[model samples]
Target: MFPIRDHNPSGRTPFVTYALIAINMLVFLGYWGQFSAPGLDQFFYTWGLVPEQILSGRGGLTLITHMFLHGGWMHLLGNMLFLWIFGDNMEDAFGHLRYLGFYILCGLAAAALQIAGDPTSNGPMVGASGAIAGVLGGYLLLFPRAKVDVLLIFIVFFRIFAIQAWIVLGIWFGLQLMNGLGATQDGVAYLAHVGGFVAGAVLTFPALMRRGGVQFWRQTHGQPPHPQAKYRLAPSHIPRVPRK
Candidate 1:
């Protein structure tokens, strides 16, 4: 199950988040025509992340540039989905400038941790997962108790529930850690995820404090600024068949 959307939205404008989505989509489409298995492998190797290059201080700038690249459709789709889910609220809270800065910083911090973990490897790391992880991080801080909708599919059963942001984000983080430990060499960059999450959380501390700290929860009643979305299921239409 994953988040389709959140019930809570920020009180301010979220232009940065919208702009980010647009940029990532545009960039992906720009390079999508070259998505071949072997070609992508080479592209990711050259632009994704190469530990040897980073450690040697050559092509180190790729740490930042790589965040904007994707290996394939699923990679890009998943990252963009998460960004769409959690980014707007963070941008609302931090505004365009600060949110944008926060995003880049998280990406940098993510790269820093990955490099620190394996300074001798030569694998290229890419994708916006790190920065998007930061968005999830910031979301946890600003809306720990906010309502997050998650879709659950069991066999033919489908359902959705509004759970606390803490639970969803916390579980997501734990999964990353578990995956990171199991097979970081496989190119998931769990280190980057952990690093970005930590950075986003720490970075949002000041803003949380400024909002009257824990007291803000009491004031906002643990709800988002806007109303929850009302999802309507269209009437099901199933045609009957008869056999002679």
Candidate 2:
């Protein structure tokens, strides 16, 4: 399942989120043609976060650079989508500058955790999944009751459902934790997701408490501070076929 949007609207324009999306897109486009280059792998290794290099106290800048790189178009789009959906409200909550700082910190924490998982591996980790995971975590804490529209696809069927933020985020986090625990080696960095999420929740805890902790939840009912938005999807046009 993937979140299509949310019912919470920010009172002010989320400039930082918009800028981030633009930058990610531009960065991807800038090196789009380098995928087939003979030195491409070396390029990624130099810029992407490699646990081995990090452990050796070299390539320290990769932690930040890797956040802007992606393995493919889908990789970039998926991350950008998550950031677009949940980032605005966070930028709204933390303000522009502070939100940027929080995002970087979460990414750093994510990279650290992923590296710790297998520091000797030479595989390069790229993409913004970790940082976006942090945004998801923060969204969950501040708006557990907010409504999120998610697109769910079955083998031959498709549907969209609006669910509570907590349910959506909880399931996402649980999956990350589960996958991280399972024995597997693949492109996806599950540990990064887990780390960023935990970092986000921890970092945002102070803000939550500053808003009065339990009182904050009570006051807003775990929803956005502004009026809740309502959405109605257009009916599907695909004809239903009778089964034999």
Candidate 3:
């Protein structure tokens, strides 16, 4: 199951989140389909975070650039979707500038951990998953009881369920940790995700303290500080076919 939306609504427009989505999209469009497989590999090597390159004391700028370079459309879409779902609330909490800074710091922490995980590996890591994972982390801390609508698919059957944020993010973080430990040539930077998530939570701690820590949870009931958004899922119009 994956989340499609959250009930927590920001008090104001999340300009930074929207700008991040747009920037990622535009950067993807700028280079997508413009290169052959080899050329794409070259491009990623140049812009994506390659642990070996950093270890060699070069390609230092990629720590920031790699957050905008996605491996494909699905990669870009998935990351952006998570950001869209969880980012606005964070932007509201941290404000626009602080949120942006938090995002970058998370990305940097992700890169550092990925490099630490496998310093000699030559694979080029690309995507905003790491940074967005940070958003999820912060969201979990501030709004654990917030309702998130997740779409679950099993074979040909599908359903949507509104579940608590902690359950969803907890399961996600667990999976990343499990996969990271058992991973071998999986091509996923699971460690980066883990690192980003941890960084996000740590970075958001001060805000939690400012709000009175555990008392904040008590006051807000671990939900958004304002009224939660309500959604009604419209029934599908398609008629079911009768079995022969």
Candidate No. with top TM-score: 3
Residue-pair clashes per candidate: 8, 0, 0
* lDDT by residue for model 3 (31-92), tens: 98766656888899999999999999999999999999997888999999999999999999
What is the clash tally of candidate 2? 0
Name the regions of candidate 3 deviating beyond 4 angstroms. Answer: 35-37, 234-244
The pairs that clash in candidate 2 are none
RMSD of each: 6.0, 3.5, 4.2
Ordered by TM-score, highest first, the candidates read: 3, 2, 1
The residue-by-residue lDDT of candidate 1 on 123-225, one tens digit each, is 7788899888988898888788777778878899777777888999999999988887676556588988999999999999898899988898788765664
Score residue 169 of candidate 1 by CA lDDT.
94
lDDT scores in order: 0.82, 0.90, 0.91
Q: lDDT, candidate 1, residue 74?
A: 87
Q: Which pairs of residues collide in model 3?
A: none
Q: How close is candidate 3 to the true structure, as a TM-score?
A: 0.93
Worst 10 residues of 3 by lDDT: 231-240
lDDT of model number 2: 0.90
